[model samples]
Target chain A: MPMLDLISSTGVAPNDVEPALFDAAVNQDIDALHLPNDADLSDYLDALPRVKSIFVDFPAFTDGRGFSLARLLRHRHGYEGLLVADGQLIPDQFAFALQCGFDAVRVKRSERERHTAEAWQAALDAFDVTYQRGYAVKAGPATSIFDARLTAAEANKTTDPFSA
Target chain B: MYRYDEFDAEFVNARVAQFRDQVERRLDGRLSEAEFRPLRLMNGLYLQLHAYMLRVAVPYGTLRSEQLRMLAHLADKYDKGYGHVTTRQNMQFNWPVLGDVPDMLADLASVEMHAIQTSGNCIRNVTCDPYAGAAADEIEDPRPLAELLRQWSMLHPEFSFLPRKFKIAVTGAPTHDRAMVRAHDIGIEVVRGPSGEVGYHIIVGGGLGRTPIIGETLRAFCPKDELLPYLDATMRVYNRFGRRDNKYKARIKILVRETGIEEFRFLVDEEFKALDASDIMVSQAERDRIAAYFAPPEYASDIKALDLEAQPEAFRKWVETNVHTHVQPGYAIVNISLKDPERAPGDITAEQMRAVADLADKHSFGEIRTTHQQNMVLAHVRQDELRAVWDGLVAAQLEDANINLIGDIICCPGMDFCALATARSIPVAQKIAERFNDHARQQAIGEMQIKISGCINACGHHHVGHIGILGLEKAGVEFYQVTLGGDATQTARVGDRTGKGLSEAELIDGIERIVDRYMDVREGNERFLDTYQRLGAETFKEALYADA
Candidate 1:
């Protein structure tokens, strides 16, 4: 099973998919993944699908994109799958990665695993909702009648609607 | 004042509820700080230097007596008993805790006021002429149009996440009291067409910042009916093409500069077609309804007599200094100078707000105005009731008659309050006002503007004064630089820096030298600006250093 069918400018885009940027997103099977170095992990939530996941290459330890994307995919994206933090999965980001949402994290079975998992669990117990856009579904649009009226928009006002 | 209809009430109530839930979620560790910053900013709540600061849009700076009283109440209960009137024509409370902001917003919502989009990188509170409807020489009252823009721009989905904040100001007054028709992201001024029909001469990219620009004329005559769609189209264009990557080069003004006004105009026109397809006819009609709500209040037909010669010496001085003529018969514009002796300019206590509100209800229309000069204005007052209102104002410590004169200054809350400021503006303004509080001497000196800023970010409007002082820090010691003859009017221009910066002590000495030079060379009764213009900066510059 792979959420890898989804390709986006911001996320772990399938290398096999041909793509322009900004206005384009495509669905394809994931063989190899390429996460843009400069892309902010914030917009990557839109790239995650409910089904499958992929192995993210962490080019460097200082480059924390792999960890940030891992957390978003797991905790924020609610994707339950393997996230291999290859390349330079430094000791520190591994803990933060696990705290964010990464469940099955890859850091070569090393002496640091026991120490890192404790820190990750400790971090995970601290909070929730680590995003600007709401991830959890609320029952309805959060608003009221009066706010709705003022924001009733340009098309709704009988008089100058913009006067609100 | 536009009263909150049922629709408005419901919206605010719902927003409050939603925010309450958001707070709960945060407390329960369901939300993180970064996730919640934009949400809070959208609601007009900012985590400032210390506590939260809530800025409410006083759209066009007009307030009903009741609304002013409500603000007073909010100040008394939640803040340090006063509000700071910002240069952008919004009021800010600097010391509210995060938890209290929701309730403060609720109180504002009761009066059809809310802090929405007052902060975020979105369309900001629309500003207009303080005298709007009452001012002479207006093609039309600009407040209605301002209100219309406030409604139209709020929470615009596409434009909400702009690269930076946007400001729009409007003025119907040919004199440009609103500072409209200047460099803003969008500046609008009402103009008379060939048939005497009212049209708008829209200007775009006018602003005050690191790279200030005088707005270029975007359209010569935008007919009244097409104004809304044109504005919509303009925003759409900006939303689409405006820079988002680099915050510094994000304001529409910068884009306009980079692309050139002619190309920007073409892009805007193309976007305007898209807006036409949306066809917001209902909203256009809604403008009429909102306009109706703001129609001039019916007044007394009998004109009350104002005896110009029956004034005492002090009364004459006050009258000559503070009062302005009104378009309505026997009515006058009463200025409640916020810059009282030794008081922080523009700071009004909660008690003072209530007092002004009461005065407005009795002597003027039940309305109060917060001028761009950091003072409150009683826009429509009967001539006969002037004495009574003045007495009340005097008791409240707001009766200083220094409007547009020395010491009636515009000063930013510099290093003392604003984290962004480099030096203290309050001290500079206070010292200057103290030096010239002698009423007879000030009257002799005649009309002059002495503005101060804590930093180059001229929040105190130091750039547009007859005598401008910008406070800076030189090796941790406060220093001030002077700029003369900068006007913030139809012909807005930033003053050139005069000489090198001087220490705080020498700053006043320098100001005195310049003033003395004006007295010696000025033609009789010519104002400071007139003298400075006629004599040139070189003359003023020579005087400043002559006695140094």
Candidate 2:
């Protein structure tokens, strides 16, 4: 086991890893590019269509720049290919990373054995509810409790509006 | 008295289960301490100097009698039989074993309460005017909107890991701003447009920390329905652009300051327009549904009036000092002071909690409210039952009768409890309270907010105090810096720091010197802050160091 692990919602392992350097990737026509945590996504927005995978680095798990970058890549640039979250990610934050539009996570080699595929699966299902919108969940984007309550309240309306 | 729905109940329980698992793993060596710290913090568990402190959220300061009883229960069962009320209208139990936290959370969940988002670098417990629904000057109750935000910001995916903790405060009354909205990250004042459409006047970037700054108005009149969308956009902008490199400059205020409010507003507006507003917005009907939960409890209009003549002098003083006017006639709001002598300010014992719960049930329609100044309020008490309520409070040692007075001080859990504190605040506050113990003198001093913070974090909100005392460590020795003329009202301003820091021994003497000068310079019953405003901080600064 190389411990070069990539976990996705579909449980499929990633293929043909590419170098992380931007100029090298551009010169070599690499399909995948792992950008540092501080990388500006707009600079590479045009190349997103051509690229198959974009792994945003999380230098520190607490530093959430990767969340913004992932969202920008997906929502702003419309990068539909696999978006990977790389480095220093805790298993608990997997859902947040995924919700921010990352399709996969490249677990560090040392911790790969402990963070198994089943563990990642369990981590995703840790919480059944989210209040945020624009998240990419397995069952498609989930509507918040407020929206659900509104729908229920609208359907159950039976009398004069202000009588109660 | 907004009861939790099935959704809220389930959400909290699920969070408890998740935290329980996280805690178990941490204990079993499966999860590292680093990984577990954030999880524990998000659940409102902090590793304090002595033991684990668990902070419980009292959403918008609204608590039912049952909830209060449950808090009392937790205090007796797990803690040291008392809980300290925080400035943000939450309660903190000083000692809880890490293993028992999950159980405590489960207990909290049973009461439709959990510590989720209470201590994390996320949207914390939304605070509002404690007298929100009952205030005579209130345009509308702000608690409903505050609750809506509480739901929206709970476990928000992107905002859960913010650069710094964010706070949001709402107020319905413009004249009597008890929430201190200007001192929060997001200050929402309920407003009505010229065409008679109700909405919010949003203020962004205002906060109190090492660098205290008042929030600037982002939108003068944001349509009521557009609030959620606008807030979503604003938070998104802050999460993406807020500085993370420096911990001290991580608040949205710094970003707003550095990038300029106008540019920050533009960025937020651009994001607001670009994001699909429909995806984030709740319908007016949904808003109405939430509002209906906070509707006024059934009232009995006919009630006996207070016998002003028959009351004792102490009772009369208590009525004048501790009671507030309510929107509904014959109803009065009674403030239960936690700043008693020889006790830590804002600490209520388990017995006192149960007593207050009993008082709520008997006099205030089984409801209680927590004020930002760390006092409890019986917001719907009948005026005729004032004497009875006073008697009950007196029996429980809760009738301090010094709210908004000199003795009723706001003191943070300083070096005594808080790990971040450089000097002790409780003793300084106690000494000040002792110095101004005379009822007549305190009444004469009039409405003055004396806030004390342990460190530059400003948890005691010393920036906006009428008289602020900041405790800082000077070469391993405790020292206090004084400030004057800070106001937390519509005309919000940070206090000006006086010259020189005083030693712990000189703190009380220095304050006395300042107060004596205030007494000497005062004319026509001017408050301390008013006198300071007229005479300026320079006079106080000179008087303070005159004897040094």
lDDT of candidate 2? 0.85
Off by over 4 Å in 1: A1-164, B27-29, B277-284
**CAPRI-style quality class for the chain A–B interface of candidate 1:** incorrect
lDDT (CA) for every model shown?
A: 0.70, 0.85
Alpha-carbon shift of residue B15 in model 1 (angstroms):
2.6
Task: Encode model 2's per-residue lDDT on B287-372: one tens digit a residue.
Answer: 78789888898888889888888889999999999999988989999999999968988999999999999999999999999999
Query: Highest DockQ among the candidates is held by which one?
Result: 2
Which 10 successive residues of model 1 chain B have the least lDDT summed?
A: B274-283
User: In candidate 2, which residue pairs clash?
Assistant: B206-B215
lDDT of 1: 0.70
